[model samples]
Target: PLQVKRGIIDKQTGKIAGEEEYYVDRDECNRADTTLAGLLKLPPVFDTTSGQGSVTAGNSSQLSDGASATLLMSRERAEALGVRPKLVFRGYAVAGCEPDEMGIGPVFAVPKLLQRHGLRVEDIDLWELNEAFASQVVYCRDRLGLDPEKLNVNGGSISIGHPFGMTGSRLVGTLANEMLRRKARLGVVTMCIGGGQGMAGLFEACL
Candidate 1:
């Protein structure tokens, strides 16, 4: 979520807020086709669709969306200015699943993250699994030991709306805000996509 506020902001542009934007446009169309062709340089799909020849560019899609944020300084820096920040960020990770089985992404991702941090499933205080589908969340809970009670506390896409390209960033904003609201130290955000792909990210609230 982004805001248009009336205020004098202070900060150098050098500081990077965690958010980033990635867009694909017409320039990428030929690259996409060429890349597919090269990968066809191998076997399997190439063996099947042999001699499809160098792929040609086709129609492209245009999409646009908005998102921005507020950055928090360290506790010491905030206190120095007599301002206290509410939340701190911890870590983030993303995973991919087969588009068809996209729903299972979190199941694979959650354990990977826990192992990476040497934490257990129980250590996660909250979760904000994107409700790409009712079954995605349902399946994740049963497989990842996620407590349903601690999942998606503020209602999700099912209630709001799904804005394609915008969903990822939106989930990050929502999960971070909700973690602060709930006084949770750690929270996870996961999303499943069409074509059996998915991603999950974990964050820690700042002290």
Candidate 2:
């Protein structure tokens, strides 16, 4: 069984991220919680493997159609255009893992990104770890010592379907808005790639 997690929790305002897109698909949209009774009813998506394979459709991110976009340019350029900046691109890092066990990509990538900036998990004020699957997300959460309080304060891909091309930018968009509302400093958006790779980026809200 996996921890049923959906919706981001805004630490500063104590609000839950519940956009209409959170449950775009009709499959069990906002249907159940972490109750054992509720979990027992979710259907398994994959067959039982030797040591792993506990993922179920309920705990997995839904595949659906979506799109997101962000404009990246210099602050001077934005100012010249009278456009308000949202975030600053601080740094980025990527790492590889076993393709079959790609869920742990963030586990390796985030640490490298953090070390690059001489930061620790505690230094991050917010996180958007894509919920590709409950299995890998949980593994990263525990392994990275990420604060559940700051992680995915709004609904993640588990709630809203993941659009591969735009997910990373989408996460940065979500993080940028939340960080501004919360008036927070550092936020990190990390997710495991479909293949055996993992990527993470460091961002600072332009406040």
Candidate 3:
């Protein structure tokens, strides 16, 4: 489903440019190495100096502000509301990282949640990654070996506007709808937050 959208920075002018659609192909993503070394435009995870093993890099500023919300009702509640419920939250997890390295939050959170449910990362059929910054999502993808094609089918807030106070629900609804569209059974939503929090939620489409 469409999860996040983003734009490019024109280095010469130091301004954001027109946004574009980014997609992850599930098949291609799972086959890559642990570092996801094959992706064409992946964001850099660490900086290396002369003969240095590894070093941290600064955060990217290509992020926009946005919010989303979704309403979920129990089976009984749905009946009372006179609406059919098509999905349910299965589980959720959150992780922390250095504030400046906030992009890696999802990488830690998703694996733990998936393990808690006894589900392998491969078991998930779809994914929605909140595009806080292009680098944030890319960092998770490389670290987690997530399939880019299966990552975001619709698009993201980068292309759409990030309307604060509504992104969570928006992402949930979009993922649920995408699951129904593909007739898939499982989906996951993940996002990186400011100040070092990474959040992820798992869901299944109800019959």
Candidate 4:
């Protein structure tokens, strides 16, 4: 599923260059160390009760190895280099949250972001909220009243794989590309950090 999505995006942008083997595969699924099946069978990290623990390998992000890069340059520089720009970096915000409830990072970060830019949630055309965990995504979506249709249309970390440090850039790249493809105006990319922090950035698709 993810490979097909990447293929389509690669065709559209030609930025990804080519496919990589980091994506999950049948051979990797058969291996004990790298398999999602093996991870799902282990004891619960938080709650032990059946179907009670909110965090699980199935719902949580996969620990995969990958890398992504986003080229940030001024319009003048890009034009001088004869390259087409995709999106304009509007603004960004960072907010701290309780370490225990770190998953709720976006809940606080997003408001600060909007207020700083003097914009409302409805002003944004698309949103990419990292699926670090299913619980976190659900909580943010309900609390923020995000439209399902405007969110992560091509799936997220849970479906593809979270490469930890690479996820922020990955989200930004995905949002920019999708915004351009849809001819949308505004887009936002937000993610919850590991140690009680959230970061968000807003962008405008270049037409």
Per-model TM-score, in order, reads 0.57, 0.80, 0.66, 0.77
What is the C-alpha lDDT profile of model 1 across 176-200, one tens digit per residue?
A: 7777777889877777766666666
lDDT of predicted model 1: 0.63
| Deviating ranges (above 4 Å) for candidate 1 | 1-87
Best by TM-score: 2
User: For candidate 1, which ten residues in a row score worst on lDDT?
Assistant: 55-64
Model 3 CA lDDT for position 206: 79
User: Lowest summed-lDDT stretch of 10 residues in model 3?
Assistant: 53-62
Name the candidate that leads on lDDT.
2
Cα-lDDT of candidate 4: 0.82
Clashes of each: 11, 6, 27, 0
1-207: candidate 4 lDDT, tens digit per residue? 344234323666767666544444532212344566666676655787676776766677767766799999998899999998888998999999989888888888999999999999898899999867888899998998889899888777777677768888899888988998899999999988878998889999988
Residue 103, candidate 2: Cα error in Å is: 1.8
For residues 1-207, what per-residue lDDT tens digits would candidate 2 score against the true structure? 223436676888889955333433354434555676777677666875564557787788877655688899998899899998888999999999999878789999999999999999999999999967877778899999998899888777777667678889889889999999999999999988877889999999888
- Sort order, TM-score high to low: 2, 4, 3, 1
Error of 2 at 105 (Å): 0.7
Better of 3 and 4 by lDDT: 4
- Tell me the tens digit of each residue's lDDT in model 3 across 72-158: 667788888899777888889999989987767888889989998999878999998875455667778888888888887776544
State the weakest 10-residue window (summed lDDT) of model 4: 22-31
